[model samples]
Target: MTALVEMKDLKKTYKMGETYVKALDGINLTIKKDEFVSIVGPSGSGKSTLMNMIGCLDALDEGTYFLEGTDVSELSSSKLALIRSKKIGFIFQGFNLLSKLTALENVEMPLIYQNYSHKNRKKKAIEALEKVGLGDRLHHKPTELSGGQQQRVAIARALVADPPIILADEPTGNLDSKSGKEIMDMLVDLHKQGNTIILITHDTYIANTARRKIVLKDGKITEDVEVS
Candidate 1:
């Protein structure tokens, strides 16, 4: 199977005054299409930095990153933005929804960026919400929903674009145990439907849900373990 993502000798460094902070030392990994993988580590382990690069939210200082066979390091900011908007979907621990928008509207926002017609955007947003089992709450505001439900809306927003890669950053971090499990189950369901998932979490239990685990420590991959 062709890999959906490949990073070779990826490195990211930040400058603070005269000192350079290495966020990612050298990460080499391949994620196949439709696979579920997790980046696992303790705090300040560079896992989040790796996620930032993968999501196109940040750039690497050195090495090559290929997303669906396209080199990203050489891409201009505009091109990178296009790729990020069209090919990657992001989920955050906080759900990041506009408090004023309803779930349907929140999901529709990404479609607007893609220039979808109003009818199609609404249709797609509803479909995405249903996929995450939130069809009935389409008109509800994020504030009206439970933590898990708001995150479901976030997932819906991510799915509305139908991006090839779904990059989730500790999606269940703020939820209660039951809700966290439910969210994980939803992710598994999406994975089963052939979505490539890249989940980042510090929790071992959450990380173990993925078939493959990449553990990071001190800005480097300490182990790449396959659990399934």
Candidate 2:
């Protein structure tokens, strides 16, 4: 099978004062289309660093990284932003919604970046909310929605662009158990429908929901296992 993502001897480092922190070191991995992957690690295990690199939110210090078969390290900053906009969708632990925007408008934001016409953007945004089972909550502001509902809106925003890959950072972290389960169910549903999903979480139970789990420790992968 062809890989949607491939990392070859990838390393990321940061400097603080006179010390250097190795956030990711010589990590080699691959994820094919339609696969759901869970990254599990401790708070300081470099999972967040890896997630940022994988999400194209940060650049790698060394090694080769490819997404959709394109070498990301070679792209210019502007080109990289274009690539990210075209290929990736992101969900975060925080809802990150604009307080002034409604759920529908939040979902419409990505399309605005893509320069889509207003009519088409609204159409697509509504469809995305419908897909996330939030069609009826389109006009609700973030404050008016429950935590799970807000998360569903976030997922809808992630889907609006119809990007093949979704990089979610601690997607279910802020919700209660019931809300977390609902969010997990939506993720599984999306995966079943052939979305490529990579979820970062510290919760083992949440990680178990994915087909494969990669455990990181001290900026290195300590274990890689398939659960399904």
Over 1-228, each residue of candidate 1 has an lDDT whose tens digit, in order, gives 557899999999988799988989988989988889999999989888899999988988999999999999889998998898888999999889999999999999988988899999999999999988999999999999999999999999988898999999999999999999999999999999989999999999899999999899989999999876
Clashing pairs in 2: none
TM-score of 2: 0.97
Candidate 2 Cα deviation (angstroms), residue 172: 1.2
Model 2: residue 166 alpha-carbon error in angstroms: 1.0
lDDT of 2 at 58: 89
Angstrom error at residue 195, model 2: 0.4
- Across residues 1-228, which tens digit of lDDT does each residue of candidate 2 receive? 558889999999889789999989899989899889999998989999998888788899889999988898888888887777768888999978898999999999989888899999999999999999998999999999999999999999988898889988999889998998999999999999889999999988899999999999988999999987
For candidate 2, which ten residues in a row score worst on lDDT? 78-87
Q: Model 2 has how many clashing residue pairs?
A: 0
Residue 80, candidate 2: C-alpha displacement in angstroms? 2.0
Report how far residue 174 has shifted in candidate 1, in Å: 0.8
